[model samples]
Target chain A: MNWDAIFTSLRLASLTSLILLVLSLPLAAWLAFSRWRWRFLIESVVALPLVLPPTVLGFYILTAMGSRSPLGRWYADLIGSPLPFTFEGLVFASVIYSLPFAVQPMASSFAAVDRNLVEVSWTLGISRLATFFRLILPSAKNGVVTALVLTFAHTIGEFGVVLMVGGNIEGVTRTVSIDIYDQVQDLNYAAASRTSLVLLLFSFIVLAVVYSLNRNSPLWPTLRKR
Target chain B: MADAEKTMTNGARPLQVSIKRNFAGRFLLDVSFNVGAGPGTVLVIFGPSGSGKTTVLRCLAGLESVDEGTIRFDGEAWSDTAGKVFVIPQKRNIGYVPQDYALFPHLSVRGNVEYGIPRARREAEGPWIDRLLLILGLTDLQQALPGSISGGQRQRVALARALARRPRLLLLDEPLSALDAPTRSVLRFELRRQLKQLDVPAVLVTHDWEDALGLGDQMIVLSGGRLLQSGSPLDILTKPENLAVASVVGVETVVPGRRVRRERGIAQVQVAGLNLWAADIDQPGDEVYVCIRAENVTLEIGSATKSSARNHLPGVLLGVVAAGPLMRVKVDVGFHVDALVTRQAVEDLDLKVGSPVGISIKATAIHLIPR
Candidate 1:
């Protein structure tokens, strides 16, 4: 019952999460430590997806990446194909939709770190990069793990943006959520129920893992003891 | 000025710092001082919070960039704002111990100490860390995380971690301020011993007068982000330049007056409706403040006697307040005078709120500050 669709969704989610993590790490670090006055403007812009309607975001991305637009024409000329209605387009859309998920936790964790620790490390002759790896990352490991999980799960459950940008191409753009929608519309009740159950189990398992990890994180010492 | 010349002649490689910074058009810090960073020399910066004592220390360590002026350590320029010669904190070869004792929470005591050991020198100098831990009594606690240990132990670990670097200069910012009173006194003794043994030029900033007097080889007093005076602790306590410096160095009373006459070496001064004679009057008829320390004023039950003390005044006891080991006796002759007496002395004299007593203070004990 649409096993290829499920696998495609998993692949998309994994790739999007990996790319988002890479892109967001330095951005989050800068947001945490920079003294720039316009930092809040950038932060607000990054957080826009958290409250923006997914359809509106998808419509904008579609318009910006369509074959008629300048970016879409340039992409078509360079990549030999238009960006919209493709697997690549789906990945890009998911990354944008799940950006706040990846960034907020990381940025907050980075900001929450004691500045004295960083200064102490620097005075000890530890470079900024070394300090980030040896001290900052270990201290903020919990938030990072949460960000990765949220981004992956959010991408897996994406429907509105993926539908608008990817256009339901079989074995390529049609992920599990899109397959389930198609099944319900076609009155394939048994198939839709099976797919829905899989998603429900996946969501519960992801949340369970996150909660257990959070309990063990040293940031919540009381909860860890409990 | 004589001390500066003597320090220069001793080949002790002094750190010369003169900086002026104007911050936000509200605060200005103008300070200039030189300290001979000879072996076993401890320079203490004493001031209240927000007085820029820590700022001066940070500037010397290259932690704070100066707006104007230069900082030179052993003839090497650490910062010269006009010349655009500024060294980063890491390259300054200094061990800085902050007030919070910022130990890496993830690392054990041993790991923290070894953090600053250069990779090339780690093999040859690695044993120094163990030696430092042993000296600081942290050998058994080497495996413990900073949070797992007690506050006093964490302080030792911070000291050990800084010393492990074998730094050319050491800067400590109120290292013992976080401990309990008992622990603080205990650690202070230990820290003084360690600083002596390090044989490195060290600057410590503390608001506690006890630390300044007990640990400092030279003391620089600061107030309101400005240098009030710089001298030996004894000199600073006995010859403070102004009323502000006098109060900071534990002088309890500052009576403003003018010297009316100088007969021989003694100067008769009119102070608060009483005529008191102070010795060593270099400037006659000068407006001055007579600073008196509570400990210097002895309480006598009878009238003025022919004792060694040159000045005596009869006064009625205003109050007896218990202050730790000593009793603070407030007396009013015509003006209030405080005498710090022991509990045994209070009980022996049967002194109460209204008992009349005589306060005998020597002419030498009175410090003068030009008003």
Candidate 2:
């Protein structure tokens, strides 16, 4: 099996997870607290990626980032490289494809936080920024961990979107899923089985660690005898 | 103006709050009151649920802004809707203890208490923190998180955290409402003592009249988001403005009656097909409600004796309910009259359902409110 494809997949997943986490924190907070009339519009738009066919989403991203598009031309002018079939392009597509995975759980967790906590913090003379870091983030740790794990796993296992947008380039864009696809197409059953087994086992282990941590989380130590 | 001057000269910065807001076209709250800012002075806003009591506290704390009018805390405008002066809650320097305590579940007791204290000045206020922990009886549990502690401890931690910042005004919204009965009883007195020691202007909102009567030096009654009345607790209890105020204050029984005669500021009324007399009952021929407290009704087993309490009615016992130290004995004298007597009284008098008993209420105890 190709090790460069495995390393590229890991790099893409980690970068996508970290960037999505940072970008979605404020978005999830807004979704949780805002009473705007048009809030559901933004929510449905974010969740669109979850239901759309991965190739369809990739096709849209590819169209948006084509050299003919204004953003694609501007970015291509700003940078020396063209947009399609690059590691950066793959990471950007993965972020959008996995946006709902990072945002939904985060929004739910933030909504679960007692509104009284925020109000009391404000009354105690704590600023909103301080309260978010000091109170909200700590309370919503489980959801944040879930978001990270899901985003990383989802990005690692992505095939159709990366194939459509990143085009299965040998070392740069070919991830483990794309490698397994190529091995299967080349009629190398042994290599395809090995890579697929590795992906399945890795996803299981990550999910197991997350679930075990959730079971022992400080917020709900259900096994402890009071 | 004179009251404000007197309070200011005595080193007490009186809080003058007057504000109005239209809440979703359901209720319009218009309130104006003043409470002297000093130790041992608690201004309680007492009303039932959805009566705008908590809203008043929130408005003062800057958690909720008012639509019109100004809120002056020691002559500094915290909110002026027309003048465009709106101070955020963080800048108001107010301590607010909500109903759920709202302790930080992630932080240790000490960490939560010190959260509001300026970190740069935390070391200098170490003794103050120690004093608070000791006074609140939380020294041993200082390192524990809120979830690991009892309800009362969480409440103390929330209060300590609020006080750590040395707020100018304190707002307590039903601080003891979430606790069990025994804890609530114990914390009520302890909270009152601590609030007195803090010596800051406070506005406590509670739906429970017991909290208001026990902790409030002065009280305001709110119903349907309007200020019904404001006075001493005893005054509000003895003379509510209308039937709504009387009901919210938890007057045991209110009997609609027509005044039959008036003599020496005392009026005799026909109520529920029975004759009753009440003092401070001027304007004969006026419709009124005779509000009687259950605690004021005394139970007797036999015939009426020569006593100062002139309003005695013979009735049969309807039912008996043991409520803590007192037993609520419902007596039927044409209408049901609840008399809160001791459990020993029930046992001593052998009073049960259908047993003959006498309910004696003093004429002066009857609070007459115009219908």
**Whose DockQ is greatest here?**
2
Place model 2 in a CAPRI quality band.
high
Q: Could you tell me the lDDT of residue A198 within candidate 1?
A: 94
Superposed model 1: Cα runs more than 4 Å off: A188-190, A216-226, B260-268, B277-281, B302-307, B322-325, B343-350
Which 10-residue window in model 2 chain B sums to the lowest lDDT? B1-10
Q: Write one digit per residue (lDDT tens) for candidate 2, span B1-371.
A: 45445666667777878899997887899888776766557888999998988888888888888999889887799999889999999998988898888888888999998988878988999999999888888999989988898888888998888888888877888988889898888899998898888777678899887888889878889988888888888889878878888888988888888888888877888898899988765543479888899999999878787788979899999999987778998999998888898888889999879989998999988878887
lDDT for position B5 in model 2: 53
Model 2, A107-216: lDDT tens per residue?
Answer: 88888888888888887778998888888989888878888988999999898899999998899999999999889899999999988888889889988888888776
Fill in the DockQ of model 2: 0.82
Candidate 1: pairs in clash: none
DockQ of each: 0.66, 0.82
Q: Model 1 over residues A60-130: C-alpha lDDT tens digits?
A: 99998998899989989999988999999888889999999999888888877778778877788888888
